[model samples]
Target: MNENSHTMSERPHLRVVHGNPTDEEVAALVAVITTLNTRDTPAPPPPRSAWSDRRTLHRPPLPHGPNAWHTSTFPH
Candidate 1:
């Protein structure tokens, strides 16, 4: 027997332990369960918005010295 084999093979064997289920019903149940188990992780949260970000709200100390007020408004 192959070392990787479990039960009779590598695959898990499904059994109807409670009820006599038809093959198609068992297949549908498997499909639903597989889908639930393997669902894609939720898309990562959307990237943070720049305007609303806390870093954008940060302010540098007010400018100082001669003509500071005027130079402050103009790009350095």
Candidate 2:
């Protein structure tokens, strides 16, 4: 009457279908199967933005017809 009652008396239909687990319900089902087979501690990657090392401004193309809106080769 050990080894889980000899595997529930050699699987009497798995012992009347699921009916025998009380060692504190097999220690709370082995603590929920060891917390669902552990493995969850990865979250630390987000902090690098000096405006993404700024560098991208080649503006120069807006002058074509009718005093191009009182143009002034922008660069005040």
Candidate 3:
């Protein structure tokens, strides 16, 4: 055997096996899948916030001119 060659015993052995489900098993599987598919329902809408009322959502107007900063009490 060459230096780079590997013996049959040293090589990895792999095998794949395929299966066929019986008719009854396939029908049961389909029934389960269909049940799962039909169980999904649309979620309910979220509740409205407390600030949803326009009357209670008031905010003071912002100051705008050069002297506006002097009129305002809040620090920049």
Candidate 3 Cα misplacement greater than 4 A, ranges: 1-17, 42-76
> In candidate 2, what are the lDDT values of residues 1-76, reduced to their tens digit?
5655545337643232477776787777678877776747566899978667555354567787988777856553
Question: Residue by residue across 1-76, what tens digits does model 3's lDDT show?
Answer: 7775678777634222467777787678779878887788666889878878785666667688998877677743
Q: Estimate each model's TM-score.
A: 0.41, 0.24, 0.31
Output the better candidate (1/2) by lDDT. Answer: 1
lDDT of 1 at 30: 95
Q: How accurate is candidate 3 locally (lDDT)?
A: 0.70
**lDDT string, candidate 1, 1-76, tens digits:** 7765676455666756797989899999999988987776566788977878887677766789999988789753
Model 1 regions more than 4 Å off: 1-13, 38-43, 59-76
> Against the true structure, what is every candidate's RMSD?
6.4, 11.2, 12.0
* Candidate 1 CA-lDDT value: 0.78
Give the range of the ten consecutive residues with the poorest summed lDDT in model 2.
8-17
Q: Tell me which residue pairs clash in candidate 1.
A: none
> Which candidate has the top score in lDDT?
1
